[model samples]
Target: MTHEVTDNRQNDSTLASSAFEHQMFKESTATRTSETEMDIRDRLTIKGGHVEGQEQVFTEGAMSLLELLCKQFASQVPQLLSNRVKKQALIDAGELPNFLPQTRAIRDGDWQIRGIPQDLTDRRVEITGPVERKMIINALNANVKVFMADFEDSLAPSWNKVVEGQINLRDAVRGEIEYTSPETGKHYRLNDSPAVLICRVRGLHLLEKHVEFDASSIPASLFDFALYFYNNYRQLLTKGSGPYFYLPKLESHEEARWWAKVFAFVEDRFCLQPGTIKCTCLIETLPAVFEMEEILYELRSNIVALNCGRWDYIFSYIKTLKNHPDRILPDRQAVTMDKSFLSAYSRLLVKTCHKRGALAMGGMAAFIPAKESEMNREVLEKVRRDKELEARNGHDGTWVAHPGLADTAMGIFNEYIGEDHVNQLHITRDVDAPIHARDLLLPCEGERSEAGMRVNIRIALQYIESWINGNGCVPIYGLMEDAATAEISRTSIWQWIKHEQKLSNGALVTNVLFKEMLVEELANVKLEVGAERFTHGSFTQAAVLLEKITTSDELVDFLTLPGYEMLTGQFG
Candidate 1:
């Protein structure tokens, strides 16, 4: 049966409104610097000032692939994002998201994603971290089924970092990665064996200003994915782990369709088998949640798994429904996977994937076992229970934020899926996630406490400082935080303030109160990190930047958007 296409809302509304972004980013087929065997060079436009490692990053062939991908698909990014805004507008106007009337046919279409690769068949434990060399080495060596070397949320994309990350990934793929820790004087290298590697590029909404295609900045997703694939596809294939990916933040099946096309073209270009590339789509947004079957149907041939990105999913829930007074979330701590809405989403994910002959992966166990303290031990126990829930509910695997928690998650999966078996095809229990779209809008209830406010302020300040220092993932309050946690921390405070939310302590959360609390936390963070480090670090600017983004009249979608401009020294 042929599936009917019903993304008319896309064609009629948002796609038509994104002319400005497209006209600005038309692709150029010219040469930059010079072409050389030592380095692939080509013609390109650079709006941002020269990036230190840009030269090595844009080696001729790699840059060529990036240019081509942008030319073909970058024009479509703005519309996808705008579609999100339009849906948000509808939600604000009192219409909540439901399964698309047009796509119901597609959702019920008879199809399944191709079987996962052998190396990925048993992804019982996956570790994720930034693209920095030592972190990449550690993650790959962490004895998990897969290591997602991230160029997106877990990374602050400084020009040097972006290029250097590509180089590091190349080296890691060839088993030549080596790094010596500066502070500890400790050497880092891969273990005798490394986990299967999968790379997560930036979302479609992000832009790479350092490198322009025609006269405008290209989509960072294309830039990151193209560079990695152009440089290392063959190497990965030769090593028996085919080109694998974790596609993040897709809002619609149309976006998924675009990604599927790219995979097909790249496979043809490299003369690899048609389904050589595999992707695991992250259902992190409310809109994407409604389109799960359609998303998998769109990319069925090369898709292997679907993961529940719980934190960002929660943030997306808030962001998409910001204007609904009835939907304002409570404290971040109050929300957990066990909530009816999140649990419903999880069960639906497992049922959707398993029915389609694909793997339904679990969410991140962000609680890191830190310092062996009592609190840390308790968090570890919580992490163990979380993984067990996933295993019991038919999730094929789970993710851990730290290597220390790997064994804990791994043991749970082994109990259910067998030490030698993965893909969780044996679990045949019927999951009862009979959730409606409104249930996805779980009511936000709990004390908007002064304590919660303090936690937000302190974590945001520390996270931004780390981000400014080029570190995206940091352990704080026993949870492994990357850009997503930091975004949630700040945005929650902003949303709370916008609503003048009353705390459990009876104080109203206002802008005035938030700023006062922020100042105190900034000072506290400075004292905690010591005078010299704080003085030299990006603490002051980070504090200012954090305040500006959070307190503005407009709610920014991703903190990284503004933060990226600051990192590359660019502005509106």
Candidate 2:
């Protein structure tokens, strides 16, 4: 049987208007049913407790049967069950009828197993911060839909910071926060606007070490902390009105289920309604990848969206593919959109989310242009193109490292989302066909040797130089394009920066700033390579070596773009 295509977009307005209507229907039905059941129970009680019975003899077997009948009748009405038991039953059944109160069924369509509104998809920007209060206020003012105050990877390993993060969350929810300017240090109370604040808690794997200061002991203290903060904050926040949380680094669907249970427990203790607290998981780890569908199913109603963790993903890939020398990532440039594995994984993620009727967001393209120059212009252009490609490839949204890049990202989204072929609807006869990533990489003939690395490096440097000079568009060899090429170039530069660069503080080059600093490094490499001579090499060999260096330079330029400045600001 063929399913009807009901335009979800058109139904959104009707759904909003019918919210109160649905509520009335449920309340009326529940009230009338309760009254009828109570009437029957009262009659039963009266009949069971007769005046003769009070005086003396009632048959024990008859009384037992009467009691049994009453119990059976009561059990038939689900509303008679304790809220906890009802909720548990619903969860076990992989449904969330109680949470919605309006939607009778858990599954909406083929894609969405949960009854959550796709309103999360309407939210454009996600602002993250190390400090909860500050980030929350900024996001609210910025009018971004999701504000993630991070306590995990962005924060350091300090007990005080953890306590502070929790306290800030409490304060923000209470609307008692005072925003202070970082530059002027002037403080003011913010009570008017509140964005949907979501906390990125420390990953479960790091809980033991973080709380106990030892890997062996599970951080039981931390669990208490979570319980206390979440319970109190849910109550305080709901006093006015606010959204839920964004859970990061979940390893399995069971973990998500556990979190949902934790949420329910906290909500019940705090007298908050079920589903008041919502969650979205970040698909960062390898385990999380395999369990994506199950996790989404488990958190059906409360789970809103999912994001890819690119850096962590890269780290995982390296660890997993360590045994294969051929798969070694020599430079960050080698890990471009061109990489077969990454592209394939991205496509799978997009398809999976869409299939489940959830928003599939692209990972961070941390291109922030530093300083107002031609290089910055080139960087922005490249970032715009990359974001466009992400949107075109079925991703609802993509991440940007910097706030300055936000406008460009939005603009790219607008330009592409409305285009004919870009947003064209495809009617498929079969629903099981697979979607693949678009072919973005060009064919290149080069030896997969150290010489190939050299060519990549040179290309990355040239791209960076063009970016810094304010060339909005640049041509490499005969290829004419905007910053997408520059971004690929920046990736190559990141590889060299990661391995070869040193900081003034003696810390390793890891952040976005270090990436931007690679332009100069690429130039230096170019000079060094010029002094060397290859006396006897074939045309293919020489071409291959040059391509490697050029690719490297292009990557460096990409990182140095203006869009990356926003990412640096996040860390700073």
Candidate 3:
């Protein structure tokens, strides 16, 4: 049933001469002038839903012309017909279905199913810490949706560390493992927790043998490495489900398609279903942006989510727009909330994913700190505002880097979930309080050199009192309604109280307890001096004693009393 075409003509002149004569015999059937030609619309015949002599006839005639053209071309390209016949025979025998059934649920829209497609929001944060059993348990207890056991960016790229990271992940996911600190040699046994475990394999483009790396031969492929990990750790996956992965630095739709095909092969070899292994594409490159729809479409719905990779996105933009002076973005540090182009692109991604009913998640808050110092608190405030904006614009979730930052991030989501506030208020006050000169009250110069410190201390104390009473809101220094500030104070106070309680109950205090106690003491005080004072070791011992005493309501009341100024001066 199959015949192969043989080209006997060796020279172009022989083929052109034979084909040229055949082309000359073709008829020109439309010599009639437009004025004398019959209108095809006038000769229409009703056949089913089609107009026979009108649209249908023209369409059928066009199809016939296409077939004739194809036949003529087939003579020149003989392999085309043979391939078509073979494909048709396979279809007729039911060897392949005409269409693949959609296994993953997706909202109806055009989507690229492959590559590192960007998240709906261009901001993403990832959390990375020592692979301890307690750290894993904390992540599970927290409200984070995508907990990535990072091996690429977070961990050191040493071979031994990589193997250790894999082992830690496998044990954590299986709920049957203990982790030992490589440095401290401390052991931690893990407990059952339900956090989703996602891992980032090494970057494909950075592999040793890739051309970009100037290698003589291709290094081991990240794709192969991922398969190796999955095969070895298959037993530890939830209910024997294969390990899930997030592919980083994917450049093209073809690359995504190739990975999808590779995954298909892996699944078949392991006797697993096509979608048993889920993937999240990290959209970090510019080319991936253009082909996003196609990439998502090709993946056929096994995608868990897309991440907005901030650091990589910025780096990629710099590289792509380097030659074009007009398109060059501002310095990375200068690229903040004011950038219109970044906002527009982010919104476009959100709209695209929402249209397809996929989760358009926000980016990470990686640089935010966990401590309760002024600078760290300010960073958390800004991060909360940014994440709230992302959620309002339709992101399903955002990332948190530190455990201390998790509560703050979650509080931002909880407050902004259904509320509509165009601009988030960093410090909100009662709406009924009209602005006045008194509202801007400033401390008289030299009246009390530490007046600002005193005000801060008062606000901190009020926060503790409200927390002790189980009230969500607390009045701070007669102004500024701050839920986040109150939360931080409460968490610090509780941490200190719990540690002290455990110590008094005859439990030995550990390094963690001592560290938290030190942090809590610092959080409760307001020093006028900066880091220089700490570096010089010149802090007054009285400040530490005062902080310890202020932990109780009676002490707070005494400090805030009308005559407390004399008491503080005497103590100093």
Q: Pick the candidate with the highest TM-score.
A: 1
Ranking of predictions according to TM-score:
1, 2, 3
Please give the CA lDDT of all the candidate structures: 0.80, 0.47, 0.43
Alpha-carbon error at 236 in model 3, in Å?
A: 5.4
- Report the C-alpha lDDT of model 2 over 1-572, residue by residue, as the tens digit: 22232223223344333433444465466534344344444233221112221221123322232333333332322331233344334433443111132321222434354434434544445655555456556655553455666665444423334445556666666666667889999775654755456666655543222222111222322332353243344343324332456676565565676666666654453344455456678886544565566677677656766777655565444333222333335444346554655665566666666666566667765665557688778888877777766766666666654456777776766665554432211212124444322221112222233333344445545543333333323344323323334334334334434344333344444444443334444545445445342222122232332244333532222132232232222222
How far does residue 179 in candidate 2 sit from its true spot (Å)?
Answer: 3.8
Candidate 3 residue-wise lDDT, 1-572, digit = tens: 22121222223343334333333343244355343122322222211222212231234433232232222221222242244345435633434212122422222333433222222112233344434346666665555544666544443233333334445565566676565788999876643545556666655533212111111222223422442344333443324333567777665555666557656654453444345455767776544554454455555435655666654554444333322323333222344432554454455456545444344556656554634588777777877787777766555567776656777766666565534521222212223233222221111111111222233334444443332222223334322222223222222232233334233244433334434544554544434334554444312333333355434332121112222222223321
Q: What tens-digit string does per-residue lDDT give for candidate 1 at 1-572?
A: 65432221222122223322332243232334433311423335655555555565567767677666776778888888888778788877888878989988776676656666667888999999889899888888886888998998889888778878988988898999999988999999999889989999999988888778667888889888888887777567655576788899999898999999999877665545556778999999988999999899989878888999988898888887777777877788988888878887888888888877789899998887867688777877899889988887799988988898888888888888875666686664564636678777777567677888788888888888787667788888778898888878888888887887788888988878888988999888878889998888888888898888778887888888777767776221
Whose lDDT is higher: candidate 1's or candidate 3's? 1
Q: Where's the lowest-lDDT run of ten residues in candidate 3?
A: 440-449
Q: What is the lDDT of candidate 2?
A: 0.47
lDDT ranking, best first: 1, 2, 3
List TM-scores for all candidates, in order: 0.90, 0.54, 0.49
Between candidates 2 and 3, the one scoring higher on TM-score is: 2
lDDT of 3: 0.43
> Which of candidates 1 and 2 reaches a greater TM-score?
1
Cα RMSD (Å) per model? 7.9, 19.3, 28.6
User: Which structure is stronger by TM-score: 1 or 3?
Assistant: 1
Residue 18 C-alpha lDDT in model 2: 42
Off by over 4 Å in 2: 1-111, 117-121, 132-136, 181-183, 186-194, 208-243, 268-274, 416-572
